[model samples]
Target: MVRKTLISNKAFGFLFLFIFLLLPSFISAQTQEYKDYTVEKGDTLWDISQKELNDYFLWPKIWKENPEIKNPDRIYPKQKIRIPLYLLQKEIPETKPKPELETKPEIVKEKPVEKIIEPVKKEYLVNKDILIAIGYIADSVHSVGKITDSPVDRTILGKDDYAYIKTDNPVKIGEKFYIIRSVEKVIHPESGRKLGYLIEILGIAEVVNQENDDVKTIITDSYDEIPTGSLLDNFYEIEPPLAFENPRKPDINGYIVATRQLHIINGTWDIVYIDKGKKDGLQVGDILAPTLQSKHKIINGLIQLINLRESTSTAIVRKCNNSITKGDGITSVK
Candidate 1:
């Protein structure tokens, strides 16, 4: 009896040791696996979760893992996302077999259902406001000229009218140019540096003939009077209208530098130029809030970016509670 008891005790000790040794491997095997997924254009967090994890509601799980994603609705292409192994290995449950029917019932007539079609809404990046904004920016000209002569000494030139301009630079016949008048000098609000001269486009003209220092041009289009000492620059083409995408706000803050309207106060649908642009990571359709600085920050309006340049951008006011004007601070939309 003593020998049997000893053998039993030895077996129990060996069993406990085996379980202790295999416990770590079992826990390690139960741990979740991870995989990386590269984001593509037009991909959204919800869509990605649905496609990769087979669960669209798990988008928050993805966002939790990637704290860099500040906005779940505004993710850019080429971003990397981590996916879990359980989702990838999930299996569909098998359907149970249906019981056989006992007997066939009488046939019944069914009503036809009506199909309803919904109209698709079209989205646009460039609208009338955007075009006006572009025109305002294009009004600034570098090359200059002066009206030398016109038929009957006409001070104002219109469409289909011929005017002779004197410029120091050579003019190529058949080239088109814009006739503009200097309006004001734009200076950087912060640095006090002279940015450039803002001008008003008076008319468009095509060079019909070129003399030694005189270029005869026929006005093709005119918005205002084209008089003597009017500046000239190469014609600028307006970019084609584009559709607006889901835009992400820029990380930097700026302020309104100029407005297309001549008035001091601006409201809804007005085009305004901001000091930030592509260099600041601003994109078309990105919305910004305009705030007035006094004792405290007062939000006055919302503006959506429609056109972008190197150091500046054009935005159209979408909504306004108070009048917006130059010097108002602008920041990324929250």
Candidate 2:
């Protein structure tokens, strides 16, 4: 009887060890499988979420899974990240029901009602002319003159300030010119070739005197601070006709290449640079819609062409469901 009991005890111990060794493997197999992703250059949480989870708004879920990423904006390339299984599985959490609450009777009081008449507010849509008038569409191909000197010791010159300009080009006395500075280089979106320089209007000046290569001028109107080396160009005074009368969509399709402030993200009233221009048959007062590339291309915003160059144009954001960003496609619209 003692020998039989010993053998049974040894068998039970072996069974226990076998179950302990196999338990971990069973648990691991039952768990959901996660895909591993290696981060690449120019990768952002927003973009990764869009690529992995099919929703750009799910960036927070990605951030929650990677606790080591303290700053979601500063993630580096070559980092290994696990795309959570929950995101892939599309698991919906079970919601708990609210407990029933005791109700109390409320007292109602009757009062005399009066009819109120409110004035209707008129809605005004933004037009291309308005954008040009507001200095959002400053573009000039004519080379003016550069400010060489200012009357006062101040660095910035304004209206009524005397400024000496130097230009190889001839300027007629009493002729008004726009003071501008080259700010950025505009590039083609697809070919990535340099198109032209974007000039910013600094102020306005009129030629007071002409002597050799030097032209004496006085700042007449200032939009921004007029500094030395500001180039002078022919003032654009004629306003293009507004297309509100007969608006029509163009057949040409393009994409946003840049913005006025050179921002990656933009919203309503912000100026954006498009690949389409006069060469592409885009004209002033042409309206375009900014759209996202999806299974069913959705337009998120509206933009109006205000300034057209040879191969590019500047547009003002008229309306947007959300903020417009770089890489958003553009299509002409009525």
Best by lDDT: 1
Q: What's the lDDT for all of these models?
A: 0.69, 0.68
Worst 10 residues of 1 by lDDT: 260-269
**What is the per-residue lDDT of model 2 for residues 200-262, given as tens digits with 9 covering 90 to 100?**
666778888877766788887765567787777777674444334334468778887766542
* Top candidate, metric TM-score: 1
lDDT of 1 by residue, 90-209 (tens): 675657978987898899898988989876433345433235323444324676566777866887677789998876567788878877776677676667766556556677888898
User: What does the lDDT come to for candidate 1?
Assistant: 0.69
Those runs of model 2 whose alpha carbons end farther than 4 Å from true positions after fitting are: 1-144, 209-214, 261-268, 293-296, 332-334
Considering only N, C-alpha and C atoms within 3 Å, which residue pairs clash in candidate 2?
144-232, 145-232
Cα error, residue 183 of model 1, in Å, equals: 2.3
CA lDDT, candidate 2, residue 108: 83
